[model samples]
Every structure is written in C-alpha cells, then in structure tokens.
Target chain A: MIPCAVTGIGQTRYAAKREDVSMPELVREAALRALDDAGLDFDGIDAVVMGKAPDMFEGVANPELFLAGALGAAGKPMFRVHTAGSVGGSTAIVAAHLVQSGVHKRVLTVAWEKQSESNAMWALSQKFPFQPPVAAGAGGYFAPIIRAYMRRSGAPEHIGWQVAVKDRRNALRNPLAHLHLPDIDLDMVKASPLLWDPIRYLETCPSSDGACAMVLSADVTGDRPPAWVHATAMRSEPMLFPGRDEVSPRAGAACAQELFEQAGKTPADVDCAEIYVPFSWYEPMWLENLGLAESGWRAVDAGRTALDGDLPINMSGGVLSSNPIGASGMIRFAEAARQVRGTADAHQVDRARLAMGHAYGGGSQFFATWLVGTEPPG
Target chain B: MRPVHIAGIGQIPNVRGDTDHDEVQLVQAVASAALAEAGLHKDDIGFFCSGSSDYVMGRPFSFTMAIDGVGLWPPKRESHVEMDGAWALYEAWVRLQHGDVDTALVYAYGKGHGAPVDGMLTAQLDPYYEAPLGPSPMALAALQARALIDAGRLTERDLAEVVAHARRLGATHPGVPAIDGPLDVDALLDAPYVATPLRAHDEAVRTDGATAIVLSVGGGGPRIGGIAHCIEPIELGLRDLTAATSVRRAAAWAGLEQAGSIDVAELHATYSPQAVLLRQVLGLADAVVDPSGGALVADTPFVTGLSRIAEAARAVQGGAVRALAHASGGPCLQHNLICLLEAR
Candidate 1:
C-alpha cells in the first residue's frame, strides 16, 4: 500500500449547541483551522471527503451538495460517505485512500453534526411504511444490549460509572470537549435520570454541535513529524439478527482484530487507544470487544486501562465528552494521530509509540478502525 | 493498486414508475441477477456500497432494509452515498483500488412517484437562496432552456427531431418502454408550456427504479473497456446552458481522444434538447447513438445514470458497441458523469 500520514488536524469547541454559526460557518471554522494547521491553502487540497450521520439530523438531504463551496470543494471531485455513526472514521479512511492509492497527494477529510438544529431521536425514529419503529431510539436499541452484557459478563453496575467518571474527568483537560464536567464523580453519574432503563442520561452521550477536519498527506511532505498511517479497516454486519451480540459487537471485534494484525501489533502493545464511547458503558464493553481486555470486561474494573496504568484510552476525552455524531469517530482518529505526533498538549500520552482509533454505528454493527504510529512501521 | 473491472451489470426496464414491485424487492432482484450472471454468490462480496436518498423514500436511512439483501453475516466493509448509483460505483471502485478486497457490490434505488418529486428535487438546489423561492426545478431548467433558445444555438424544431429519434430508438429496443408515436415539434411548441419556452417532452418524467453493478479487482472480473466521470458546477449560472462543458470535461477525463473509433454511444438525455446539447458537448455525432433509446423514455431517478452505464455495457458485451455511454444528474444537468466502455 502507498504510505499516508496525518499532517494536520483541527476541531471546534464542541458544545450542546452553537447557534452563533450556521452549518457552513461551523464546518468552515474546522476546515480553515485544519488548513492553517497543515500550513496550506485551499489550492493545496487535491480532494475533499465529507461525512455526517443520517441526513435527518440536519434536516438537509445530501448535505455536501449544498456544502461544497464552503468546504473548498468547488469545481473539484468531492465525495460523500455515510456508514452510519462510523462515518467520520470512514470519511478519514476514504481521504487516506486517495493519498495511499497515489490518486491524490493531499486530501481533506471533514465530518460534523449540529444535533441542536434538529431532534436526532425523532429523526432516527422516522416511521417507515413497514419497518418496525425503534421506540427508545439509540439508547433503546443499545440498552437491552447493555443488559445482555451485564447478564453475560456478571460485571457490577459500578463498572459503567468508573468509565463515566474517568472520561468526564479527562474532559476537564480538553478545552474542546462539549460536556466538560470538572466536578463530576461516580455517585453523581448514578444519580442522573434514566432515559433508557439501565442507561442513565449521564451514561449516554450528549448531543453536541461541532465539526472536525484533518488534512492527510502521502507521507510527511515537510519537516513536521507525521502520524504515519499503518493500517485501516472497516466492517459492518446486519443491524439485527437472531444470534448477533449487541454488547460486544462482532463487527467491532473483527475490525479491531484485522486492523491490529495488519499493523503487526497486539492489544497489549498499543500505548494508547481512542475507541468510540458515546455511552459510558461502551468503554468497558468495547474494551472486551476490541480484545484489549479478555472475555468479560474485567480489565476495566481492574484499573488496567487507567490513564497512569497499562493502557490509556481516550486521553482526549473521547465521544463521551464531545459526541459530535458524525465527527466523533474522526476526532478519535485525529486525537490518536495528535498524540503520536506529540502535538496533544494536555491529553498527550507519555512516550506514545502506537495508537488505535475506532468508531461504530448502525446499531453497533458498522465499524471503522485505523492504526497510527510515531515511527513508520516496516 | 489492482485494476478493477465491471464483471456484471443489471437493471430493470426504466419507466417513470414500477408499481408492480416494491423498491426493496426491485433492488434485490437486480442484485441477485447481477451476482448470478457473474457466477458469484452473495457471500463472495467483500465490500458493499449503495446509493439512494432518504427524502425520496420519505424516511431516513432508506437503504437500511436493502442491506439485508446482502445477508451481511461476516459483516463486510460497507458504505453508502446519497448520490447516483454511478457515484456509488465510484466509491466501490475506490475500495477495490486498494487491492484489499477482490469484489465490491454497488447499487442505488429511489422512487420519485410517491414523493413530491418536483419540489423534492428543488431541495437539492441551493437550499438557502434557491429553494426558498420555490423556483420549481423544471422551471429553473426552463429558464436555462430559454437562454439556450434565445442564443439561437438551439431551436424548437431541433428539440422535436431529437424526441422523434428517441421514440423510434426506444420502441425498437428489447426492454425500453414504448412512447406515443412521433410527436409534432410545432404542436409540442404550440402546446401549453409547464414552465414557458419548454414543452412537456423537454421535461423528464418522474421516474423511480433501482440499478446495480458488480466490480472485481485485479482484472478478476469482466474486462471493462474504460471508465470516465466528471461534474459541473451545481449552480446554473456557472456555465452556458447550450454548451455541455461538463460533458467535455468528462470526455477528456475518459480519454475520448485515445478511445479511437466507436460502434455505439448511449447518451442520457432526459430532455430531447439535452440530446442535442450532449451530441455537441460529447462530440458523438459520428458514433452510433443510443440504439436502446435514452433517458427520454426510460428515465429512472438516482439509478438512471447507472442504468446508462449498464445498458452500454450490455451493448458492448453483446458485440453491439465498442465505445462510450453517458449519464448525468442534478437540475439542468448541473452535475454530469460519463463512462467510456470498450469490448476488448
């Protein structure tokens, strides 16, 4: 495969709502910052790949059609990608392929979601002519799965709180995180109202309005250290099937396994990880699903994934903090790259060598993963 | 990177509406036929990508149910685009370009019959300034058509002659829907105008259907002749309506100069005048043009551009054409895509 590198990254100050800027202005803010970080201009970008959640989230159909100009994709080959929630990660992967395939020297990847503009729950719960309605929306779809995990793994309810407190505390260090709860704790999280039975409001990701962009190049084109892309993979399964495991999704596991194998590393060797955790429980759940932890998710409760412990996960606060639906996965990817580039200030992992970034959507079936390293792998 | 080939193509006869089959079933039948034609199974596909619009389906994530048609058991790598099927094919082709997967499946489906096809199309226009005015997409196209007519670059007679050819060509085809015999240009012009200066034939019917194409990597599939696609500015004011600048851009990208002499060329002309403009734009006057009719007859929404590619591929595989096929989208051909196919 042709070599690729993450040369620049930019993200907006995520929040519950950003009425100050329209969709175009919001996306442009991130795009311009990314361009500035890359030390390049609009003419320098060879192509643009845009990503977002379902069109209903924005009340716009095929957003990129109208967004082409603001994204600096005018009169250029612009591509749009939608792979459910993992769209951001897939969007980045698509842009990377343009560079990796020698089709383009540089590609700008952008993903954003302004959920405040529209009700995502109602949007996602659109009643089709024949399809069954998802009563609880995303949380309802995932709550039962969370219960199944509790039953199968025999893990205590406190494990979810541990993850929530850890990520919320991590958000204290991230200036861009949406729900930065500097004073939150386990008891506080347990007290939050339950939206989807067993899944409290605090346990779920907050709806946020934000954008994220990254200018990826084919190898380090300048003196700046590049976050070399080692391997990238994506996988998807049926939304609902008889034997599907919703808690530790097979798609996620297979994606991470193949990605790790391609990058020639094991879960233990990963210095840091940036997994999608829109819900607090997903931290422990995906930990087992990603093979970073063994069969049951005991690793999370054992403190093996603590910041100062064996593996540092979501040092950039993760989706639990920001949760810009379309851009969350890519934020994970960008943050992972930043850590390896030694550009992450407050959330940097010490002496990070390799990192893994992940995102999933479509009832936890669609998955995208990428491995990046400070030193180029042989 | 591996050279990806178009192994098989499948599409139903494109009429304005196909009420006989549900959209999902329609998509599934075509996908099944295309796979079996290539001697492949649903299990063989390593990648899956589809294109369709939620608005067209009157719901969000319209293609979600269609994913079941693939029986995504092993959870293959997949993606979707709210674009024409041809563009979805482009995404699938990009995945194949990596040499990571050998096969990619791409499909698109949208039914414009139930939805406010006209008003819904306007949504694709500039939402902030253009859509608010409610300049019906056809009315906007007519404005550009009037400019082309006033420029003396095209005439009403030219438009009718193009439609006459489209009707005859469509009637003789094996699968094209038969249109009412030969229309009168003067009568058409004299006919009440829906948007002034343009006749009903000048407007495409509200079409709904699905199309699918199978792509194989490293020459493992059918030997595709050539593939070329291009885009025009989304705004009408960006270019001359009479001039097919986007078609020229696509032709150049397809290496029209190096493609040598051709046997047949299928052009997607939703409107007869577009046929005239496309001929001038793609310079296909010397080639065998749309023996299987054109968009004037069997115009499907979203999947129509893909239908063009499939029809041309069938012609080439049948030893009928050794040249190019064109497809397009957006109002006034605001967005254009061209594919050059050859039988080696």
Candidate 2:
C-alpha cells in the first residue's frame, strides 16, 4: 500500500445545537479549517469523501450532492460512506485508501451530524420484527450490558463516575469540546439521575451538532511534520446471531488484531489513545477490547489512563465530552493525529510519539481503528 | 489505479414487487450466486462493501441487516454507501488496490414497495428549494425532455423508437414482462402522458431487486480497465439539465477516449430521453446499447446501476472485446459513475 499521512485537522465547536449555521455551513467550517491547516484550498483537492451516521438525522438523502457546492467539489469525484457511528472513522480510511490506491492525491474527508435538526432518539428507535420492544433508546439497549460488565469484572460502582468526571475535566482543556464542567467531581456524577439502570445522565454522551475534517495526502509531506498512518482496519459481523457477544464482540478484537499487525506494532508502543467512549463504561470496555489493559476497571482505579499516566486516553476529551455521532469517530482519529504532530495544545502528552484511534457501532458489530506515529514505520 | 478484475456477477430478475422475500433474503440469493460463479466461498472475500438507501426501507440502519445474508461470521472487513451498488463497487476497487486485500464482494438492494417510491425520490432533491415543491422525478425528467425536444435533439418518435427497442429486448428475457404488440410509433403516441412530454412507456418501470458482483486483483473475471464517478451540484435550476456534465466528466476520467472501440454499452437511463442524452455524452452512437433491455424495462434504484455492469460483463464473457457500463444517482442525474471492462 502507498504510504499516506494526515497533514491537517479541523473540528467545529460541538454543542447541543448549532442553530446559527445550516448543515452545509456547519460542515464548511471544518472543511475550510482543514484546507487552511494544510495550506491549500479546494483547488488543490483531488477528491472528497463524506460520512455521516444517518440521513434521517438531517433529513437529507445523499447529502453529498447538495453539499458539493459548499465544498467547491463540483465536477469532482465525490463519495459518501455510511457505516453507522463508525462512519467517521471508515470515511477517513476510505479516503486514505484512495491515496494508497494511487488513484487520488490530497483527498479531503469530512464527517458531521446535525442531530438537533431532528429527534435522534426517535430516528434510532425503529421497531423491527422478532425483537422485544423493551429496549427503548441507545441508552436502554446498552444498560444491561454495562450491568453485565460490572458483574463479570466485579468492578466497583464508582468506575463509571470516575470516567465521567475525568472526561468532563479534560473537556475544560479542549475549547471545541461541548461540555466544560470545571467543577465536576465524582459526587456530582453519582448524584445525577439514572436514565438507564447503572447509567447516569452525566455518564451519557450529549447529543451534539458538529463536524470534523482532515486532509489525507500521498507521500508528499511539505515542510510541516506529518502524522504517518501506520495502519487502518475495519471489521463487521451480524448484529444478532446464535452466539454473538455484544458485550465483548469478536469483531472489535479481530479488528484490533489486524490493525496492530498491519502497523507492525503492539499496544506497548502506543503513547496515547483516543478510543470512542460515548458512554462512560465504554472507556473500560474498549480498553480491554484494544488489549491495552488486562482489566479496564483496575487501570481506571490506578490512574494509568490519566493525563500524566503511562498511557493517557482521550487527552482532547472524547465522545463523552462531545459527540456528534457521525463526526465522533473522526474526532478520535484527528485527535490522535494531532498528538503525533505535536499540535494538541493544552492537552498535550509529553513525548507522545505513537497513538491509536478507535470507533465501533451497530451493536458493536462494526469496528474501525487506525495507528499513527510521528516517525514513518520501517 | 491498481488493476482489478470482475470475476463473477449475479442479479435477481427485476420485478414490480418481490413481496415474499425481505431485503436480506434478496441480497443473499445474489451474493451466494456471485461467489459460486467465481468458484469461491464466502471466506475467500477480503472486503465487503454495500450500497443502499434508508428511505427505501422507511427506517434507519437499514443496510446493516444485509450482513445476515452474507454470513458475517468470524468477522469481516466491510463498509457501505447510501448510494447505488456501482458506487459500492467503486469503493471495493479502491480497497483492492491496498495490496493487503485480493478479493472483494460488492452488492446493493432496495425495497421499492414499502413506500411511495416516487414521493420518496422527490425528497432526494435540495430540501430547502426543490423538495419543498414536491416535484416528482417524472416531472423533473419531463422538464429535461422538453428542453431536449425544443433543442431538436429528441422528438416523440425518437422516444417511441427507444421504447420499441426496449420492448423488443424485454420480450426475449423470460422473467421480464413482455410488451405485447401494437409496437409502432402511433401506438406509443396514443399512450397518455404520465408527465408532460413523457408517455407512460417513456419512464422506467419501478421494480424491486438486488445485484452482486465479485472483484479481484490479478485473478479470474473480466478485467476492469477504468472506473470513475463524478458529481454536479444539486442546484437544478442553475445547471444544464439538457446535458449531464457529471457523466461526461466521469467518462473522460474512466478513459472514454480509449473506449473508441467498445463492442457493447449498458446505460442507466431511467427515462427514454436520458438514454438519448447519455448516448451523446458517452459517444457510443456506433455501438450496441442495452442488449439486456437496460433500466427502462425495469428500474430498481440502487440495483439498476450495478446490474448494468453485470449485463456488460456478461456481454464481454460472451465474446465482446470491450464494454462500458454506467450508473446515475440523485435528482436530474446529479451523480454519475462509469466503468470500462474488457475480456480477460
């Protein structure tokens, strides 16, 4: 595969609502920022690849057609990728592949979701046959799994509270993050209302409207340092089958194995990670999934994933701090690239040389992950 | 781009409604057939990509259900697009160039009867401008056809001749409904206009179906010479509806200059007048068009584009040296994909 590098990154200020701007304007904010970051305009781009969670959230079908004008991508090759929440991550991977395939150079990839335009709760809750109706929303679907993880790991009840507080504090450092709870603590998280059993309102990710963009270029690194892409991987499986493990899906494990093998590196080489954690428990769940820690709860208790710890996670906050669903995964990817480029201001981890970005969706059956480094892999 | 081959192709016969089978069942039938035709099992595929629309099924995360049909066990690398399966095949072709992957499976399916297909399509227009007016696709195509007529590029008899050719071809296909006689231009002229300047036979038949194709690098199947897609802005009023700039751009990128000797061409022309416009853009006036009746006889939104490729590949397998296939999406042909194929 041809080597590709992330030369630029941009993201919008996530919030519960971005009423001031329309969907096209919301995405242009990130697209122009990324173009400026890369020191190039739309004229330099060869192609554009877009990703979003679902069209219903924004009430548009095949939005790339309508958005091409705003992107200045008329008469250019444009593609739309939809892989559920992991779409953001997969969109980047597809764009990178275009460069890797020697088919395009300087691909601009963007992902966003204006969830405030419609009720995402209702949009996601489509009743299908041969299924119980008890599972109401996304929170309702994952609550039982959190309980199962608590039982299986025998972890303390405060682990979720700790993650909520830690991420919220990290959000204060990230100006683009939606939540800036400087006074938040473990007590406040535990005191919050329990929307789903074992999952508190504070422990859940807010419905945010935002976008993320990046410029992926083929082996033509200008003067600025590039975050060399070491590996990219995606995995999918049936959401419901005979022996499917929703809590610790084999798809995620298989995806991580392929990603590391492609990069020719292991978890120990990773300086930091930006794993998707829409809910607090996912921090621990995905940690174990990525083979970073033997037990996620134990690592949380030991502060091994803190800002100054052995392997800091979500240094620019994470999905828990700000999630626009579709753009959440790309934000993880962009944050990882930022860390390697030495551009993650205020939340920078010292001496960070290697990082991982991870995202999964659709009952944990779809997974996309990538490994990046400051120095090109041998 | 790295060279890729279309090793096998499969498609369900186009029908107005496949009422008994669901989306997964429809997809599984074609996917299994495709893999079987390639002499491979499901495990041999390195990547899986699909294209589908949520509005077709009237729900969210609709394409995820297609995994059941392909047997997503032991986990597999996969991605999807909300467009047509031709776009999915384009993604697979790109993935096959990564050197790590050798073979890929691409498929697309749509349920046309669950919702008012025409009304749902109107929603695909610019939401703030065109969609608010609720102008049906036929209405938009009629407007385009009117422009073609005024420009003297097409006429009522020209459209009737196109329909006559499609009906003649449809008669040969066993499953497709036969358009019984009275096949003269006068008969076509007698049919009432569904949309102004577009008779009932002028518009494509809205059908439900699915298609699957296997793509491999340095392996069996018809070799893909070039595949590319381009798009135009959805601002319909500002753009030239008479000519498909997107198709012209995609064809040029897909090596249309070298396609001078194409033996066969399959076009995704949902309306008769579109066939006229696309033929000019592709410059295939001398080549045989729509040997398998094209989309006019049966049009399944997501599947039609991919089936064109399948049909063109079948022609190449039947000894045609070179073939071209095309697919379009969005309102007034806002997006276009063109693929060039040659026999191995």
Candidate 3:
C-alpha cells in the first residue's frame, strides 16, 4: 500500500448555532482554511470526499451535490459517505484510502452538521410504521447501558462526574471549544439536573453547529511537518441481536486490534488518544473496549487519563466540550493528528510520538479508527 | 494495484410497490443469491459496503438496520455511502487495491414507491434558490430537453423514437412490465406532455428494488478494465444543459479510447433525452445500448446505477468481449461515473 500523510487540518468555531453563515458557506470556511494551511489552493486538490450524519438535520438530501462548487470540486471526482455519527472518521479514512490506493495524490475531506436548522432529537425519535417508537433521545437509549456497566464493574457514580469535570476543564485551553466553563468541578457536575437516570444533564453533549476539514496526500507536502498515517480500520456488526454485548462491544475491540496489528504497535506505545465520548461515561467504557485500560474505572480513579498522566486522552476537550454530531469524530481524528505533529499548542501532550483516534455509532455497531505517528511507517 | 472482477450479480424484480418485504429482507435475498453464485460464504468476504438514503426509509441510520440482513456474528469490515451503489463498488475496488482484502460485497436498495419520489427529489436541489421554486425532476428534465431541441441537436419525434425503442426492449426484462405488442412512435408522439417537450413515456417508471454484486481479485468473471467518475458544477445555470461534459470527461478518464470496439453499453439514463445525450457524448453509436431495457423502463432510485453495471456484466457473460457501463447522480447529470469491463 502507498503511504499517506496528513499535511493540513482546519476546523470551524464550534457553537450552539452558526446563524451567520449558510450551509455552503459554513463548509467552505473549513475547506478554505485547510487549503490555506497546506499552502495550496483548490486547484491542487484532485478529489473531494464529504460526510455528515443525516439529511433530515439540515433539510437537505445529498448536500454534497449542492456544495460541490463551494468546495472547488467542479470537474473533479467527488464522493459522499454517511455512516451515522462515525461518518466523520469514515470520511477521513476514505480520503486516506484514496491516497493509499494510489487512486489520487491529493484528497480534500470535510464533515459538518448544522443542528440549528432542525431538531435532531425529533428526527431521531420519529415513529415508523410496523416499528416501535423511539420516544427517548440518544441519551435515554444509552442510559441503561451505562447502568449495566456500573453493575458489572461495581464502580461508583463519581467516575462519570469526574470525566465531565475533566473534559470541560480541558476545554478552557481550546479556544474553539463551544463550552468553556472556567469553573467546572465535580460537585457542580453532580449537582446538575438529572435528564436520564444515572445520567446528569451536565454529562451530556451539546447540539452545536461546526465543521472539520483535512487535506491528505500520498507524500509529505508543504513546509510544515506531516503526521504519517500508520494504519486504519473499520468494523461493524448487527445493531441488535441476541447475546450481543452492548457495553464494551466486540466490534470496537476487533477494530482496534486490527488497527494495532496493521501498525505493528501495542496499546502501551500510544502516547495519547482522542476517543468519541459524547456522554461522560463513554470515556471509561471505550478505554476498556480499546484495551487501553485493563480496568477503565480504576484508570479514571488514578487520573491516568488526565493531562499529566502516562496516557492522556481527549486533550483538546472532546465531544463533551464541543459536539457537532457529524464533525465530532473528525475533530477527534484531527486533534490526534495535531498532537503527533506537535501543533496542538496548549493542549499538546509532552513528547507525543504516536496517537490514536476512535469513533463508533449506530447503537455501538459501527467502528472506525486510525493511528498516526511523528515518523513514517516502515 | 490488483485486478478486480465482478464475480456474481443478483437483483430482485422491480415493482411499483413491494408491501410484503422490508429493506432487511430485500437486502438478504439479493446478498444470499450473489454469494451463492460466487460459491462463497459470508465468512469468506473480507469487506462490505452499501449505499442508501434516509429520505427513502423515512428514518435516520436506516443502513444500520439493513446490516442485520448480513448477519454479523463475528463482525466484518464495512462502510456505507449516501450515494448510489456504483460508488460503493468504487470504494470496494479501492479497498481491494490495498492488497489486504480479497473479496468485497456491494449492495444498494431504495423504496421509492412508498413516497412521492419526484417531489422528494426536489430536496436535493439548492435550498436557497431552486428547491423553494419546487421544480420536480420531470420539469428539470424538460429544461434540458428544450436546450437540446433549441440547439438543433434533437427533435420531439426523435425523443418519441427513443421511448419506443426502450419500451420494446423493456418488455423482455423481468424487472419491468411487458409491453403489449409493438410500440408505436406516432402513438407516443400523440400522448399529452407531463412537462413541455417531455411526454409521460419520456420519463422513467419509478420502482422499488435491491441489487447486490460480489467483486473479487483473481476471480473467474469479467475483469474491470478501467473505472472513473467526475462531477460538474451543481447550479443548472452554470453548466451547459445541452451537453454532458462530465460524462465525456469520465469516459475519457476511464480509458474509453483504449478499450477498443465496445460491444455493449448499459447506461443509467432515467430520461429519454439523457439517453440520447449520453450516446452522443460517449460516442457509442456502434455499441448495443440498454439491452436490458435501461432505467427508462424501471428506475429504482439508488439501485439503478449498480443495476446498470450488473446488466453490462450480464452482457459479457452472454459472450460480449467488451462492455461499458454508466451511472449518474444529481439532476441534469451533475455527477457521472463510467466503468469498462472485459472478458478475461
């Protein structure tokens, strides 16, 4: 396989509502920034790939067709991917494959969501014929799974509150994060309103409008250092079946195992990671699923996931600090790329040589992951 | 890069409405048939990809539920695209080039008959300018047809001839309804217009269906010669509606000139004018076009594009040496993909 590298990364300022720009303009902002970062223009790109959660959220089907011109994709190969919340990571993986497959040299990938236009909750909770109604939103659906993890691990409730406080506090270092709570504490998080049983309102992700973009190339380009892609993998299973493990899903573990095997690295070699944690409790659950932690709750208790720990995670504040649904996964991937490139600024992990980005969606069925390093893969 | 081949193809008969089966069953039937034809079990396949739309199912994450039909006990490497299944095939082809995966399964389905498909298509248009005006797909096709007529490239009688030819061939394909006796061009010309310059027969007969194709490396099937796709500007005013420049570009990139003497060409032209336009653009005068009736007979939304490739493969299986297949997306052919296949 051909080697691929990430030379440029761009992100829009995450907010509850980006009413100032239209959908096309919103995506163009990130694309242009990424192009500028790469020290290239639209003419340098050979293809464009885009991903988003659903069309119902923005009232437009196949929005890529409409935004082709805005992204400077005219007279070029254009592709669109949609795999639910994990779509952002899948989009990045697809773009990298285009380079890795020798199909194209330079590929521009983007993922965005404008939740302000329509209610995502209503769209997700719609009743369909001959099917049970999904009256509860995503949080309501995942609350039981979190409870199951608590019972199985015999962990205390403070772990969720601790993660909520940690991510929000980290958001203070990220200027683009939507929620910059300077005084976030465990007591404050625990006292917040309880939307779902065992899931507090402060532990939930916000509905924000944002976009993320990256420029991938087959070889190193531009004056800046590149984060070489070591390996990428995606795995999926049935959403609901008898005896399926909803917590610590097998698909997630398999995906991570394949990714590490391809890269010829182990969990101990990873300097930091950016895993999708829309709700605070997911941080611990994914740690165990990815095999990064033998006991997830114990790791949180010992602050191993903190900024100064042996394995720092979500240094750029994660989905909890800024959630755009579609762009959230790519944000995690881009942040990991930034860490390996030593461009993460205040949130940078010390001597970060290797990093991992992970995302999962669709009732914990779909999974996408990638590993990047400061040095090229052998 | 490794050589990719279409090992097997399977599709259900297209119908106006399929009330008996849901999306999961539709996927399971075609997937099982394709895998059986390839003599491979689900465990042998290394990668899986699907293409579908949320609007068709009236729910988000619709593709998530569809994976249940594939039966994921040990799980598999998979992905999904919001575009047509032809693009899914393209991604799978790229994956095969990575040299890690050997076989991939690609499938797509759409329930177009359950909703007002034409009205729903307007949502794909520009929300700020075109969608609010609410021009259905036929109206947009009429604008292109008028452009061709005004350019002196075609006449109303010529479109009637295209429709007559499609209906006659469509009768032989199981996916479409059989025509009664012979089709009359004069009768087609006399029919009232659904939109100006476009009679009811000029448009496609929308149906609900599913299609699956198994692609493998170093397999006993038609080998993929070259495949490429390109996109033009989205705005209708920004492009020359009378000409399909993107198709010309894609065909050139797919090595149309190198694939000497094409025997069959299956095109995803949902409207009569598009068929006429593509033939001229791709220079397929000597090739047999749409032997399986084409999309004008029975268009199944997302499934139609992949079905075009499947039909072209069937032509190769029937002793054709070389064949060309085309798949399109967006109104007025905003995006186009071309695939060339040959017998090994």
Best by DockQ: 3
Q: Compare the candidates by lDDT and give the number of the best one.
A: 3
Query: How large is the i-RMS for each model, in angstroms?
Result: 1.8, 1.2, 0.9
Candidate 2 local lDDT, B1-344, one digit each (tens): 66799888877787777777788998899999999999889899999999898887777888898778998788999999988999999999999888888999999998764557787778778777788999888888888899889988899888888888887787686435545454577889889898989987888877888899999888767899899999888877878888899999999899989766888999999889988898887888888899988888877878889989989999899999999999998777788999999988
Minimal lDDT window, size 10, model 2 chain A: A127-136
TM-scores, all models, native as reference: 0.95, 0.98, 0.99
Clashing pairs in 2: B7-B221
lDDT of 3 by residue, A1-378 (tens): 889999899899999999999999999888988888787899999999999999999989889999999999999999999999899999999999999999999999999999999999888878778798666678988999999999999889999998998899888899989999998999899999999989999999899999999999986667788899999999998988888899989999999999999999999999999999999999989999999998888898899999888989899889999999999989989999999999998999999999999988889988999999999998
lDDT of 3 by residue, B1-344 (tens): 69999998878898888887788999998999899989988899999999988887778888999887777669899999998899999999999999999999999988877766776689999999999999988899889999999999889988888888888888878878555333789998888898999988888888888999999999789998999999998788999998798898889888999889999999998889999899888888999999988988888888899989999999999999999999999998889999999998
Ranking by lDDT: 3, 2, 1
Give every collision pair in model 1: none
Stretches of candidate 1 exceeding 4 Å from the true structure = B15-17, B172-187, B218-222, B225-228, B238-244
Runs off by more than 4 Å, candidate 3: B179-182
- First chain of candidate 2, TM-score: 0.97
Candidate 2 accuracy as lDDT: 0.88
Clashing pairs in 3: none
Per-candidate chain B TM: 0.91, 0.97, 0.98
Superposed by TM-score, candidate 3 places the C-alpha of residue A122 at a distance from the truth, in angstroms, of 1.3
Supply DockQ values for each candidate.
0.59, 0.79, 0.84
